[model samples]
Target chain A: MGLGKTDKQILAVILAAALALLAFQYFSGHRSQELVLEISRPGAERLRMPVSSLPQGEQGRWHVEGAAGGVYLSYWPDQGVHVDRATCPDQACVKMGFINKAGQSIVCVPNEIIIRLIALEDPAGQGEEELDGVLK
Target chain B: MTAIKGFRGVTKTYMKKAAFVFLCVALSGGLISCGGAERAKVPSFSSTRFLMDTVVTIRLQVIPGNQAGRLGAVAGGGQPAAVPAQEELEQLVLAAFNRMEEIAAKTNRHDPGQGSDLQRLAAQAGDGSWLEVSRDTLFIQEEVERLEQEAAAVLPAAAGLVDTSLGKLIDLWMGVRETKVLPRQEEIEAALALSGMEYIERDWAGGKMRLTLAGMGLDYGAVAKGYAVEEAGRILAQAGPAVYGIIDAGGNIKTIGQKPDGSPWQIGLTDPLKTKELLASIELAPGQVAATSGDYQRYEDIEGRRYHHILSPGEGWPVWYSHSVTAISSGGLKADYYSTLLFLLPAQDALELAESIPDLEAIWVTASGELFATSGIEDYIKWQDKSGYKLRD
Candidate 1:
């Protein structure tokens, strides 16, 4: 038997509701992921916090005790993260300047510490492919 | 009229049944799509640490049900096994880092207090005594010798390009990096004289090494990090075939397996001139390594002349034939060794040498901002920035 006007309307309403649910799932899944800063030191627990949680400007300065000595770190919304002071001889971490992008890191070999920037979610499924690593 | 009414009633019941089934199907499809998104959230673990005087990062994704057979074979001891848990992967990463740290300590030439084997051997230089060293040290020295012989066979001028015995020359350059002063001719000559493979005596059977000259020394700065990275990759590969990961030790990049999607890992080659930008991107398959030697990494400007840390044993000064040389080979040690060797040679000779070698490809950014790459790597390289550099045919 052919479907009547009322039957057709009922089917359309069901289909529309399903599509709306699917759309909601898709859009919510595609929301922009947060950027996180990961601070890791040898023989110590790693600390991970969202970049937005960090205080901006001079008030954002802080220090962490590393294997060698104390390493000072500062964060600015515009500049990202920077190693203001480090007791390591090379000062390589300090010289690394501000690292803001995902996968960028500052390493202090003498202090056995590493500070890296990472995204909370994988960006691989996005249109642009994220690099696994950079060879300098 | 009664018959028509009966048919309508049946039709209406059938329509309601059809509608319920369609609704169930649509809702289930939505649920399945959500399930897929949840499944895509694979367990990923990464660890970054300071080792070998550089930052080493190991990132791994534990994919389940991909290579279950291989994982069971390696980790399950003949039992039907599932994929490794998150904690096990973390342990594997830690193990890799521990191996790297051991290699770093053993090959360190700077401080004797670290109990470095290289330093101990250097202290006993010219004593005419065979000093037993760790197997790692012996392996590195022997590899250097083999690389030297292979390079010499291909191009006589390329011989001694990667001299691990250039400890004195490197020391002088380190001082120059700090003081930013060009060393006198006499001082350079003295360092060059003390630097040569002939001064390095080896007892392969006994796993012993020594330097014949009193002031001579052995340094593994070129090979140590690569060796460590190679070993780390080996450890990861042993864990399971399903474990896909990348170990990047300050540009000495080694991949354990392909990405979760079975695609190759992409590595960005940094621009030497720009320093902050990428010159190109290269795809690296499993078991392949990419290493780069650039004047931008460690250098000093003296009177407008830039002297990098990569010193030439023959010239006793930094080579300027290329701004940066990136070498890709099957093994990390080979890649590391070749990048430095090619950087020390003229651009043409470097390209020729790289072409002659099997399974080795090189890209050279010349001192004049011209780019050249081996034929095999042309397809793999995706140029990112061409504003300042011109690619030569």
Candidate 2:
């Protein structure tokens, strides 16, 4: 059986449309979205802001009043977030360096503060599932 | 013949149109599914608080749709039950945290003024009087006693590895952390002499317990966090199967149930050498818990030697056999106890013991960065980073 020229054109158009739709979905689903830093303290409102909102440079730091004392957090757009200083005795949070990946957190036990990174979109597309918990 | 040819041409045109419609339907269906997948994420509620001297995070996935019938079954009444709203979920997490706080208060031994069960027991030591305490305290003491006896029957040397009566020894070392000065040999010996489960007496029926030795004290530091985590897990479990959650008190993790998709939860293991990097990841079955004991968490350097918090009951000093040990068990207490126990033991003994125990798996990272895991754990563990560690065959 032979098909007319118009029929071949119709088939070609349909195939192209399907391929375009697939390509759009693929790129849109995997595109990286803005990351947010979530700082939570007991008996206080959670502070969430995009990574880009942080000021860049040595002076770009935020102080969070915690249960024990306060913690100073500095951010770098490229290097992620880290605790510059903390009043807690252990200073474990300060020792936990920059954490930019989703599900990673810096916890100050005495201060009762948790700083975590969260992605605005699906983390599964990054080829890793968000960890439920970490055993240290 | 012309009429037949014309009819065939019409049929061919109709077939092409049908193919075009089918392709459009398929394309739209694919897009719709992609949209659905984006919106199919289970609603999650998470809360983090400081409890048991550690950061505890509880995250739960609320089952989709109205669960009135299931709630009625759980409530044991025919009346239609209220949907588990966001506020109810928050309350549920709060309840779990409150229960952990109760356990923490009952087991605290630091402050005598707190009048905690352990503190009261310590103050009444050697008085020849039984002091009443909370049920939580009694249960913890009983479990410690049972574990000690069980370990003695098999491995006598490992019996005192997790002694809760090491309060004096712990206090002595804790002082070292402050002063950065090593305790004299005689001082360590005296503290060790006062540390043993045998010095403690329990009147289980009357809910009373006592320390037979003067100056003897009870420190639930080894087991309290895990016990509190277990208690929190229990509360979450009672919320019914409609909710799957995780209770992470510090690094002691107790998962309530599987994820909404029925896949096992993935728990990351932190490298002791590199505090920030992940050593590996393991898939945990529902209702399972994993705990790790390592020197990296709390340690002090004195005279160029590092002394950690996990003191040996015999030497009354830190054990340096392994860098860290992670244990997986069905209950949080067992996981916590085993992680410490395995850390204290030599690597070979730890692996052997872990294999012998049912429903228990362990991974040991030695000071040299060598990894040894139980046979059962090999199937579940996926090594994430092995740059500095060697996995033994």
Error of 1 at A6 (Å): 17
- Candidate RMSDs in order: 9.1, 8.9
Question: What is every candidate's C-alpha DockQ against the true complex, given to 2 decimals?
Answer: 0.18, 0.18
Candidate 1 residue-wise lDDT, B152-207, digit = tens? 79999988889998888899988987787889989999988887788887787898
Per-residue lDDT, model 2, residue B137, is 92
Tens digit per residue, CA lDDT, model 2, B1-393: 995466356656686776666566556634544234433333455555655657566766565544534544465566544445555666777898889889988998774478998888888899899998988998988887776676567667677789899999999988887898889999999998887888888888999888999888999888888888888888887666666777766569888854656567876676677655567768899899898899887789777777999988888889999989988888888888888888999888778777877778998889877987999988778665457888887
**Residue A48 Cα positional deviation in candidate 1, in Å, after optimal superposition:** 17
Q: How well does model 1 score by local distance difference test?
A: 0.76
Question: With candidate 2 superimposed using the best TM-score fit, by how many Å does residue B374's alpha carbon deviate from the native?
Answer: 1.4
Worst 10 residues of 1 chain A by lDDT: A121-130
